[model samples]
Target: MTDLVLRPMTPQDLGDVLALQAKGYPAALHDSAEAFLSRMALAPTLNLVAHDGGGLRGYLVSHPWAAGSPPPVDSVLPTAAPQDCWYVHDLSVAEAARGLGLARRLLIAGRDAAQALGLTRSELIAVEGAAPFWRRQGWSLPAIIAPELAAKAAGYGSSAVFMACEDIAAL
Candidate 1:
């Protein structure tokens, strides 16, 4: 972690961000550049990038969003709106950087940013069998989900599970 610098993500990082995303996620899960930029505009501090000697190695895109209302993948939010909790839209690390604990660092940074905004809860849609990984990070699935919400999760892809961290303090 000492060798990598964590900083607020800027438009300049999109190229590397997209490349890392492609390597880590299925095409169905990929967010368009406009979608990424829109979220960044709403919460610049929450969106972050990890830079090392090799260049940008990882990134996290999060924003202030209403809980239980995870936006569909690639949905571009054009303006500020009332928000209840922090939403982690995406987190990806380059294949070469996977073993270095970079993802954890980015998560911590994003969580800290959200906390700064007086937000205590966080939610994310875990796609591609990522539930176990998020669970290990202290997020958990609701015991039961509403039908409409379950259908919303389905839109993310077959294995997507809606998860939340009820207390960011615990993270």
Candidate 2:
């Protein structure tokens, strides 16, 4: 593994972030620029990117959100919503950067942010058959979301699963 730097995402990094997103995920799962900007604005505390000798290698986007619910895909969120769980909106590692534990590092960073917010759990919608990766990171699909949230999760894909985890190292 090479030395890497993990820091907050910046406006200048959006181009690389979008490109990496396109390469890291399938077309159907790609997020719009507006959505990215909105997440950055509403949840700047948790949007992070990893830089190595080659440049951006991975990124993680998360936000404080309500449990049993997930914001609809490609949609902006209100700043006034009550938040009880740290929601992980996106996580990506470049193909060339895999095997370096970049994803896990980003996750741990997100987890730390969640813990900092005094939240006990973290949640995310797993798409592109990436549930196993998330599960390996200590997340679980308890089917804990409501019908409305479930419907929103479906927009990511037919097989998207809403997962949550209480293991962010504080426990």
Candidate 3:
């Protein structure tokens, strides 16, 4: 196995990150480079990337957010919201990097970053058939959710669903 390093994602990593995004997700699911950069700026400490000498492996985009109140897809918030749930906006591990536990490590990083940020929970809009994967990672589908939050999740796509990691680190 090749040695891989995890580090805070930087602007220099954006192009590769976007390319990895393309490989892991479809066009309709793509988030713009501007939005990705905005998310990194909003919560630098909560975001991370995995790489080796070969290049990008995966990236995780996370931030502090209100529990059960995820932001809309692909749009950057004009201002930061008060810290609450540590929201994982996206996690994508390149196909070649699967089975190496990079995605798990990225999520673990998000959970740890959430704890460090003083947030106890985490939320994400799981889309494109990723729900089962997240479920195995200890994320749960909320039994109930507000109409607005559910609607925001719907914007992700037909298969998108709202999931939360209660007491994030516990799992």
Query: Top TM-score: which candidate number?
Result: 1
Q: lDDT (0-100) at residue 68 of candidate 2?
A: 75
Each model's lDDT comes to 0.91, 0.84, 0.85
- Clash count for each candidate, listed in order shown: 0, 0, 0
State the RMSD for candidate 2: 1.8
TM-score, structure 1 vs. true: 0.97
Question: For model 2, which pairs clash?
Answer: none
Return whichever of 1 and 3 wins on lDDT: 1
**Cα lDDT tens digits for candidate 1, 1-171:** 467899999998998888888888889988989998999899999999999898888999999998898899999985676578999999999878898888899999999999999999999999999999999998999988888889999999999999999999899
CA RMSD (A), model 1: 1.0
Comparing candidate 2 with candidate 3, which one achieves the higher lDDT? 3
lDDT of 3 by residue, 51-104 (tens): 988888899998887777777767775556767788889998988889988888
Tell me the TM-score of each prediction against the true structure: 0.97, 0.91, 0.94
- Evaluated at residue 20, the lDDT of candidate 1 is 86
